[model samples]
Target: MDPVIVVGAGPVGLTLSLALAAQGVPSVLLDEGPGTEEPRPARTVVLREDSADLMGRLGCRELDRVGLRWSGWRSIRRKQLVRNVPLSGGGGAEDDTALTGLLPAPLHVPQHELSAALRAAVDKAPLVQRVPLSRIDTLEQDPDGITVHTREPGSTWWRGSYLVGCDGARSTVRKLLDIRFPGRTAVERHAVAALRAELPWPDEAVLHRQPPWRTGGAEVSARPLPNGVWRLDWLLPPRGELVTPEALITRIRDTLAGWCGETPAYELLDTGVHTLHHRLARRWRKQRAFLAGDAAHLLGAVGTQGLDEGIRDAENLAWKLAHVWHHGPAEHLLDSYQAERRAAVAARLRAADQSLPILRGGGGLRTLVPGAARGHDTLLSDGHLGCGALGAPPSYSHSPLAPPHTEAHAAVGTPPGAPVADVTVTAPDGTTTRLRERLGQGHPLVVLVAPGTGVWDRRHWQTAGVMPRLTDAVAALPGSTELLVTESYPGASAHTVLLVRPDGHLVAAFGGVRPAELFTAARTALGGAPHEAREPVEPGDGESGGDGDGPDTGRGQGSRARVHADGSAGLH
Candidate 1:
């Protein structure tokens, strides 16, 4: 089969491959750098919960294994710790099945570590092809697919079906497509480095945004690293004097000399100076060619949104691309990928830019800025950032897979992209879990509501037996799938159960009344096969399933099938 080809080995590119790999999408990945991948300790870590789950889905659960689970944040001004806030609270609508709906708290793990773990995770993923140093040279795209020519500088050309440029800010794909990246370069260059040592972390990430360039711009933040290491970043204005790494390090030591000794025999792992610029690509896709991660958009350096946005870009596009590859969605559907994602990136850029004032110590407007402004400045970028708005259960107002809003949601289910109420999630294995558990597992959960309202009462569900059968199958299967059935979820009727993909998209929500109609519509919307030869629903936010409610509206539970059809199979 012709596979989707991704270029870049960075966190976004690698994690994108992992998301596709999880959904069984065959992909070829090319990264033109480094041999071994390991978390560089401190390097820009994505600071969002969705990013963690996306990384986890990419097979980087190793982060939780090696990285520290940091909580809350602390901000300092002139060495005085001022703002201190927690990332989440285990409160609200806590119940027997699950707990507090969700608080958008991010997890911290180095990009290097996340990338390495993703590569390792692909070991079981035959669809993901890793080609390090396999650089791209030529590219061609047509309606059918893409042809990507790659080489080793002056070597033979290797081709691929589709070309995805996740090649970072200086993406060859962007250069090749001649896509315009428009943005202003920051007045100062950002210097990043991590030191390994034991220091009192205050159990939080600390940030210090120095005053503006009047006295020469310089700002720093303190984020915890695994194994007692501390990650520090500096934003320095160019002094017209080319500064060496040694000189820069000496300056940092001078500024932080007090804490330097406390860190023990600290070893500096990696160091690099990058000229930070705020660039946004004119477009993200052309024909069968597309851009992902940093290739499509450049996030300003005011917040922790850069990598998170890239990962979201990958997850959002992967499933849509797979749907097109499998069932041939409308070409316009494919076009929407760039539109929706670019808009999201745009939102991040605006917020990050708006927050820059705080990083520049309010830029002579300290008293003028609202507390929310400064709060967002000091916290959102530096803390285990909360994205209750977009972090968990983010929806696509225009997802091609989602059915055209009937009455535009004239009124059922939570708002698209909205989080569900907090409740317990119980498994037959006797494990009672929390809301975050479903999202963090990296595997999608097919939630089957207990059944209510005549919304699912149509002929579509009953005639096809699609809804009931799938749930029953999932229930019988031991560990391959997780089936969440709840009767009393807050804000939802007893019979309303929602199917949540591991990536946090709402796949199929029931209880509107025309049971079968909903079943059929949902199955069709998500690219699920009919029950005639139905395969188990494939989670991972990829195409895919099922049944029932207790009502005259035509819903019922699945009778236990003594015979197992777990061996059933289907085609692409």
Candidate 2:
């Protein structure tokens, strides 16, 4: 069996490859170029605290090294400061899940620097095979596997059990599969420039606009970069007008002059114009082929959320594929990929839509700017910092994969179906650590036993059959870990068990329930084989087999026992 094939070597593809590697799954990463070129014009991105935490877990810390931890943003009109707000709720008092100083607020990182960090990490990952200068021409998928047709000379075909299209907006895979991408593109074009200049501006990002808001006037944003440079994003009129290199520079100077008393000395580093778009794929998955990142959806650059959403997609899909490939889960488990991520993208898109209008000046409603800024604290705490909109955290309560929770669980901290709140957890040895730090190891399932819960025993569970069955199931799952805790949990009993999914979202919280009922819920969450096979095959263990390869390798081989003709061999 060929390795999982990941198309496009951008941040999304790189993240998925690394996530898969963490699960001991090998993957082939392909891109159009040598995969060393930096993104042009130095696109700056703003990552929310949650996104930063995810990257930190993925071992891509270099981004923080070359990025600025931006704390606040200010909006200016007619050379007057209208609204100024910090990105995070001071002291993180707005939300229970907020990790005060543990996590930084939204930070601005240049796109090229971020890509460089991810590329460096990819170079060190043993399981990721980087195939540079390779472009996917087309692909064909059958019930067994997928064969990728590339443009490589004399090597047109590459095979893999799964293919993910991380390719950007104009995705070949999505087009080949005939998936509909429905959304409108903004009539106006956005001009972005990286510059080294002496400007009279604060370190915080400044959104400046001229009067006559109804007509398309000068609306530009300037942000200080960590690398001692500045980035400016200018919005042009809807009418098409060709802007030359000198014209672009003059536009920048004039926009600055309108803000400050006079234009400051500046040296433009790079610049470009791009049209904004808002598009979402009709479907994210089709059999063994799937779409992620910009290939699945496209949002405006108003909030710089396109990259963050793409990374989240990679995190969500990687483990599901690993489970099916290594543990023989029913392929239907992949359905949750679409069910969960599509909802997230929808929420992000809505947030982006809401921000775009405000970003475009809101038809001269400048007075409301102060009011919006006042309410931004709640918006930022709700995890909408990425898109700069007042939004709520994603709710997976309706997710098919998330186990149903009770009323009591709903009233607890970090309600079921929401991302697990980051809390301090103490071990029996007196070692204290954050729950996220313990979960950073990337386990597919983590069953957290509350503090004061006595030594692990099946009899401890009030639900009899459930404990035994769940123990057996968890043991069979390759990347599952059972963590006994001595940390106090709000709204949880001593015997409460919290089942956390790979993406760190609470699926079920049960204090007391029948064993059969919980067991059924666990099976439903697993979604694959009814039960895992007990037989284990060591790669070096003496066993007659084809190719003399062990279960650890052997293309398409799983850790489970072989299915016999009598159907009595494997648990599935």
Candidate 3:
């Protein structure tokens, strides 16, 4: 099989390549710039909890070591403390099923640091071929594969099964494909600066709002990065303001004085003026080429939504592409990439738009009305204020891959299309492990929860006439399908069967022992025919097989089943 072509070597592209490699899929990473260069002043990104989980899965733990973790944020108005919002309360509920405590806290790390860490992982991955300083001239896609032409000194070309554009806002791939990028750019610009200073409150981010009488009603945000570096952003005037270096320095010194009651010495590292944009491509996929990261959408820098969302785009798409490469063509599965990610990005943009007034120093109507402050406080407490700072990640309940919604499933808090809560479960061997740890192995996971206090053994499933059918069904699908019979699942009733995707999203949850329904749901979630038998190919195999055009005539790998002493069966 040919490698998947990944454009751009930024964090998003690097993540996509690493994810594909993790799934036993090969990829060619292309970037115009050499990967060795680091961005000056080092822009920081807020690595959300979900993205952090993805990084962990990709074996990129260096980021966590180099990032600062903060649990809450502070809001100040005119140097007066207004509110202290803990991110834990932003979108997390006080329930056992909540996903708050299962993952690492959000990390504040530099983008270059993230890229470097991912690049290091990529260097270790044998499946990825990194090509730097190769500017793409053009790309042509046929039904079988895509050919990318690069205009380096040697002018080389490469072939791949698919292409993904992780290039930034001025994405050459998106432009070459003629995809329209339509959205509004904010009239207000922000002057952002990075400095090395010791702040009093180094554990939490600070948002300061100045009244109109002081400094043109600017809003300043300060976030602590690793190594005592601070990222500061000052919302500049809407119009006619020159942000020269001297003026920006003066403004920074004045703001520091107000915060510390005196001007303190600090080293200015980098300064730049940025205009916010809320742009999305009309379509994310065109033929065999797809757009991701800033190439696909551009959100405001508020809450670092764009960066995290782009990483999600890579995660969501990589698994599908790998499935297709290993199995066969599932058009609906490939299409879900755009359907799910576009909807997620659009929802985030709407949330950001709704909170713009509050973030722009106006405080919205809360400042004018007597009782409106309560609503503002609720929004802040809920963590829906800007860019979904502490809000739960968007759901794919509307995606084609998601099972049809039902009230019974919703009542159990395991609705299809929602992320699977990371819960502790006991294996048949009496070993405890996180549910998330058993997933993301580039295959669908069918979790069979034993009813009541009785653990599910192979004898029990065989007596019920469900284990054989499920084992055969799972084995027939492409790739390795994991069938786990846990002793108990949180919030799940007795005898509940869950179909979880590789990315940890619930495909469907069956309340009772329904082998036929579970089989159909597994096939549907994997984008394979109910009875299709296709073999999973090893990466870099040069055999003739399905290029996602149609079904192949190869028989799938046989199941390797093992029965433990507890009579529990493990099938792969």
Among these predictions, the greatest lDDT belongs to: 3
Cα misplacement distance, residue 356 of candidate 3 (Å): 2.8
Q: What do the candidate models score in CA lDDT, each in turn? A: 0.57, 0.64, 0.70
Per-residue lDDT tens digits for candidate 1, residues 409-527, read: 32234554444444454443334455445553333454544433224433433323234444443443312335554434555653344655444666555553233434444443444
Best by TM-score: 3
In model 2, residue pairs whose N, Cα or C atoms come closer than 3 Å (at least 3 residues apart or on different chains), thus clashing, are 1-555, 330-528, 466-515
lDDT of 2 at 554: 18
Candidate 1 Cα errors over 4 Å, as ranges: 37-39, 88-105, 152-161, 210-218, 238-251, 254-267, 357-384, 388-395, 398-414, 418-446, 451-484, 487-490, 499-502, 507-513, 516-572
| Candidate with better TM-score, 1 vs 3 | 3
lDDT of 3 by residue, 365-433 (tens): 557887454445445433422323334576888777754444324234666687787766544343556
| Candidate 2: worst-modelled 10 consecutive residues by lDDT | 549-558
Q: Considering TM-score, where higher is better, how would the candidates rank from best to worst?
A: 3, 2, 1
Instruction: Evaluate candidate 2 by giving its C-alpha RMSD to the native, one decimal.
Output: 9.8
Sort order, lDDT high to low: 3, 2, 1
Model 2 lDDT at residue 562: 28
Better structure of 1 and 2 per TM-score = 2
Please identify model 3 stretches exceeding 4 Å from their true place: 87-104, 211-213, 301-304, 357-366, 371-391, 405-410, 426-431, 450-479, 485-490, 528-572
Give candidate 1's whole-model lDDT.
0.57
Residue-level lDDT for 549 in candidate 1: 30
